[model samples]
Target: MQKKSSIFTATHGVMTTEVGVISGELELRTTCNDAGILTLAITYVGAEEWYTLPGEDYRLHDPRDHEVVHRMLTNVLERT
Candidate 1:
């Protein structure tokens, strides 16, 4: 498996005025097989906790996976 991570800041604002902020992190991990099947696990930066939105250790077969993950993370940040 291969892994990469990054820290991200989510900010809430209205009409150019900043209202709130949340620090978020994302980790992308992958494993591939000889048959070309790829599995992706998306988690918080350090915890290695798999999220339900992107699936619990989701497969990389769907193109919408990235967007779904992004939305889930955004929701988490906003609610914090």
Candidate 2:
């Protein structure tokens, strides 16, 4: 199973991406695949297109921790 979570956050500074660093009202999405791989993406709120986050992908030691990781990411990114 794949699990996903999203949050609206105002980034403190520019966030690096494949294109470049962008700042403003962005939406973050964290997805965890069945293989325990976590993928993170972001986009302008309500936008259809999504971009990969800085780190790209991560391998979670435990898939069940995706929720906590998602929350932690939200807390970190939401900092103004």
Candidate 3:
């Protein structure tokens, strides 16, 4: 598996039109197989633990997967 990671300052406002801002660091990890299938994992930057959506692993195979991941991350970040 190939793996990579990145950290970025993220604000909850990016996911919404509201004026309030909630800021935090986001860590994104992406892994791929020899067949080029991708999997993604995320956590708060600097945290030791990672999380995936309920009933779902990090593996991503379609656009719906991407959408769900985005929504999951948004919900988590908004609450943090």
TM-score of each: 0.37, 0.81, 0.51
Cα lDDT of model 1 overall? 0.41
- State the C-alpha lDDT per candidate: 0.41, 0.76, 0.54
TM-score, structure 2 vs. true = 0.81
Q: Please write out the lDDT profile of model 3 over residues 1-80, one tens digit for every residue.
A: 66666666666423322323324776666566655466656666777767542333445565335445555554555553
Q: Which ten residues in a row have the lowest lDDT in candidate 3?
A: 13-22
For all the candidates, what are their Cα RMSDs to the real structure? 9.9, 1.9, 8.7
Name the best candidate (by lDDT).
2
Query: What TM-score does model 3 achieve against the real structure?
Result: 0.51
- Candidate 1 segments exceeding 4 Å error: 1-23, 52-80
Candidate ranking (lDDT, best to worst): 2, 3, 1
Q: Which stretches of candidate 3 lie over 4 Å from their true place?
A: 13-23, 53-80
- Evaluated with TM-score, which candidate comes out highest? 2
Tell me which residue pairs clash in candidate 3: none
On residues 1-80, what C-alpha lDDT tens digit does candidate 2 reach at each position? 56565555575644657667766777777888778899888877778888887764598899998889988887787877
lDDT of 3: 0.54
Query: How much is 60 displaced in model 1, in angstroms?
Result: 9.3
Which run of 10 residues does model 2 get worst, by summed lDDT?
5-14
User: Of the pair 1 and 2, which is ahead by TM-score?
Assistant: 2
